[model samples]
Target: MLDDQLKSQLAAYLERVTQPFEMVASLDDGETSAQMRELLTTIQSLRSDKISLRTDGQDARKPSFTLQRVGAGTSLRFAGLPLGHEFTSLVLALLWTGGHPPKVEQDLIEQVRSLDGDFNFEVYMSLTCHNCPDVVQALSLMAVLNPKVKTTVIEGGAFQQEVTEREIMAVPMVYLNGQVFGAGRMELAEIVAKLDTGAARREAAKLSAKEAFDVLIVGGGPAGAAAAVYAARKGIRTGVAAERFGGQVNDTLDIENYISIPRTEGPQFAAALQQHVNAYDVDVMNLQRAKALRPASQSGGLIEVEMDNGAVLKSKTVILSTGARWRNMNVPGEEQYRTKGVAYCPHCDGPLYKGKRVAVIGGGNSGVEAAIDLAGVVAHVTVFEFMPQLKADAVLQKKLASLPNVDVVLNAQTTEVLGDGSKVNALAYKDRATGEEKRVELEGIFVQIGLLPNTDWLMGTVELSKFGEIVIDAKGQTSVPGVFAAGDCTTVPYKQIVIAAGAGATAALSAFDHLIRTSVPQ
Candidate 1:
């Protein structure tokens, strides 16, 4: 099933295998089963001595495989073809199961091994999802580390019945012990923190003990990474505290607009950004969210930034690049039905509604693009625009119109999401031109209206615009001296990746300038 180049790459990766492992397949007589067998056979052919494939297994799924270490009772399972975005997850699982050391921190490894619960994880994922691989890899690594923990990565497209039964309308829906655990992208640390319970207390204690920093950046998107790199280059004590490193960039699918780079995926670019920042002396604290910001009482005084875990971080200067998130439809059922039938990401969750009708609640570039992409996989896509006309570019509008299964309705405002107390069955809207309400039956609603700045935490701490975005001057300095803001969270007109990176650099430089002109609080 793999191409020659892919086979060669797999062969090279498999060379690191020091121990033997077996791939036990439980497949029926079907096309997908045949493909699964071919994939397993090809993998075994690469390292014949280290790997073995068997089809005499009985898994619940018709086409599934379990990778088990020879003597160690550790194992992980894949219920469908681990291709597309999950291919890396599959490869990592192979190497990790075959005794190749994972790139995770030694502390995290030890913690996983020390966990006492009988954890069984099931991750429902889509192959097109850019965010699924991280979760899959994390859970898989957990399963490999602790024999008590068992994980099964299920490809939603290949297991549509189970997905429907579970009411999973989104990718990367994680379940622990048959109950919903989490949905969306998650890091290894985040997962472990949830399971360990005391992890947050330990982390808070560790963070509280750290010394003051010269430049402490809050956020880990493009802007935060750039700020960290620039600040670290100045030879100052630099630190970054982020809720999730890469931030919203991880949810983005395709990013062709990044200058210099012709085309690259969002996860790929985010990884590159992390790698670039890691090259510097920046101390990155991932999975730590900023809850409050306290500006220094006097110039050159240390600014105190409080985290969600009650850990207060003091720094000479703080850069707020917390960024923005997808604006949600404020309708009644929208929040209640999230992940059940309401989803924000079309590229990631489109396959879940294959051959089913869905609605896009905006006529902007993102909305139209989502409609265009969903038309290929879904039965029909209806674009709803609150304005009289679409705001998307002429080229995108033209492309959207050309799609046979896509329809656009202008002057329509989404009112409420309709559901059966479990999953969304329809959407309520108002026809602004006619002053009448309307409802459309559908399996999903993709909200792509816009973004809301993540500056709610800085409400009483700094000056904010009417829309809650951080107000900044040309130098990227906030209302508070030595406190700077950048990226989507600020009053920047454009929210492009390139613009955020540039703004980050500007904020860092401005923070440095503020440091030299003011006296250090004695």
Candidate 2:
């Protein structure tokens, strides 16, 4: 039965509106008969000028109203307690009762409204992923912003077969207009831009080659490419799926230490890894994102992965080699000056500031490391530490102190990034100690603040640390049974390429073990 407080609340809200409306509800099986009787009685008491109430299964003949039965037989089911953010869905469902769709941004509305073609987007996500809420919110906001766009959010681990078949290794993957977009926690601006510009659509169309394999790996970083090589050597049919074939390594300018290769460039190292993976029969799907995953129903466990292009792939197992991206500064000019005078990874674009002035904003290990690295390449490196002192390791602090080109500014904060349209020229900062404002002329600024985990697409399906890193057990078991996580994204206390790669290997091996146990005949 409706609670007394809820009934009063509903009545008060109805009194404010003058238009005629009908109340439709999906009844719970356990208390339907009793609840319906109480609800009908309550509606009878509020028989006013325009409001009306009807029970379930009674209004099928009426075209204007619907009392849809939505429990077990319905396509949608509430997986968890509908509290907090989940309550938003309930409000939306109520608003739909008035036959009014949710509102969306005008630009997004226009784009979707003009398109007569069918468009569907299924986002794979986890709950604990830091970026998952943002991704879901962006898509949901888009739907609200554009009535023409329909979206479905799926929990990744629960749909393992579907993910494997679809060759999706990353979260927050968007399948739209029969194509895929692979930014985990994409900004709304980017989503709108892609829909409006069609640049992403064109890129998806360019990579149309297809092939078959037992295991398909996405991401050409150390994880994805390495999985392909390892899987191939194990006599399994392997293939690789990458947006750019070499992953993040392709963007690196210099790699001072990568095990056997002491001194190597990012592209050269990527080439070597690509060659090693390609030596086998592994097919590479370059510049492509897995758009959708459709798992086979039969017990044989075959999965089908649909790409941004029309091509499809069949695989028994799937390895996510999709690596993490450098975290952005989120400042005003950060986006505009990207690659022009602003960079995330010091190793990737530090040399561009050679003999020129540069600033490193952060005090963490990465920030300190970047400052130290830039000190050697650039004429002067000014490190702006937010905290009182450098938070880097003792060794790094000693090294940075010894360098003549490096200057450590304690308790400093960046206020604004000023750039001259073409590139960055200078920036304004504040000294916390002396309360003095200052501006420094520099050719480049590297934001080495910290990294944001790429797990935001997970949509609350797994456990995550407070900092948004995925929580995994010793063997890499995530909060979910079939799911495993590793690397910088996980709460492993370290964010290094070597650590990420090693974690990937552990996750793969754990997945393999789980596959063997699950696939064994009863």
Candidate 3:
């Protein structure tokens, strides 16, 4: 049940919505579906004149839903009740179905209008996933903006066969046609960028036979992009290739510590990176993953970078800036209850659980810091650690201990995420000392373990650290001449955006110097 405050807020939003729409909730008599129906009924009562609700009560499946214009054709689906962080998705969807347009960026609208041919996107998500709605909303708005595009939101748990076929282990798994588009919280610009035509596909295929570039950088994180802009400014033929721009920064929720900018989110910074790089005439080969590296000829020869698509791109010099991904807890319900009550980013989803009980998993600096940060927003914070003692720095530990609403638990191994077959309600763990299973009733959980660098494809090609980080000298040159690596993928100690961007500049200058020394006077 919504509190009076929330009810009043929603009532205000619904007052302006006058278009009639049908919310056809496909249901089973299960608790989850019943709860979903009740939620819809409640919302309907608030705007009974504009929004009508009914249930298809016997599908034997999990909670199923569809919201459509009363008379138009149906293509969008809300496979599960959009609850948890996805509650926003339901409200936004209702607005769209009721003839209210979304607030989209003008440039994004232009890109959507530029898309030609028919395109349909199927986004698989769970009601518990906070990251899922971003993708759904972006695609949903795209469908609304352009008649050439359409989208359907699938609930992963409700559609077992579809999930099995896709081998989905995470939420917000987007599929364009039959192939998986991308996963997690994708940005609106990225969705627009992926509408690659057949011409672009053929062009990428021919990269193997193209002339060599002066500098070719792999990875599109802050480092790779920075290097590309620098190299392009030097008036040399430059190219930047990566699976995605923004790298790990795209997953970060906030950027208060970054210099200059007082505050920013990952997606916003990533978009700025894209805009900055696109400002130059740099040849951006996106959606390409570096598979291996080898010399096209012998020593002092142009290098050939093999990509995942079997395309071999030739370059005089290369920079590696592939970054890292978050380290998952790998526990049950961790994925199932993600965004429902389980989250990895304290900065991204912390405010959503305001005044609610939450837990922070891990005792290292990251965990302790998350606990400290969340203590200010949440009603209470319980810190769980696998080790007997906290491993955080004394300063952070002291700060955490000072919090009145914080509790520290040592030697606790998180075993399961407990939920009511929907959103998370409690978390279960085992106490190492007492051999007792303990359950804590909390509304949210934040996991802050560590990060795993992306460098598996460079195996046997360059010298790598035991932990799989690439080895580089002060000049950013790898074991192979003309090959450079930077950012989290290299031996750079600090792994922050500011540090990576600075490293990129250093690498570009180093590559330019190497080119100047090696090139014969024309």
Residues 4-50, candidate 2, lDDT per residue (tens digit)? 88667756644544334444433344343344445445654663454
lDDT tens digits, residue span 293-386, model 3: 8864553477988887678898999898988877778888888877567878775556556678999999998899899988998899999999
**How would you encode candidate 1's per-residue C-alpha lDDT over 419-514 as one tens digit per residue?**
999999999899999999999999899999999999989998899999999999999999887899999999999889999999999999998888
lDDT of each: 0.93, 0.60, 0.80
Q: Could you tell me the TM-score of candidate 3?
A: 0.65
Q: Tell me the TM-score of each prediction against the true structure.
A: 0.99, 0.53, 0.65
Cα displacement (angstroms), candidate 1, residue 441, comes to: 1.1
Backbone clashes in model 1, listed as residue pairs: none
Error of 1 at 87 (Å): 0.6
Q: Which runs of model 2 end up more than 4 angstroms from their true locations?
A: 1-213, 253-263, 290-314, 345-356, 376-379, 432-438, 460-468, 479-483
> Which structure among the candidates has the greatest lDDT?
1
Off by over 4 Å in 1: 298-300, 520-522
Q: On a 0 to 100 scale, what is the lDDT of residue 298 in model 1?
A: 44
* TM-score computed on alpha carbons, candidate 1: 0.99
**Candidate 3 — what's its lDDT?**
0.80
Model 2: lDDT to the true structure: 0.60
Model 2: worst 10 consecutive residues (lDDT sum): 72-81
161, model 1: CA deviation in Å? 1.2
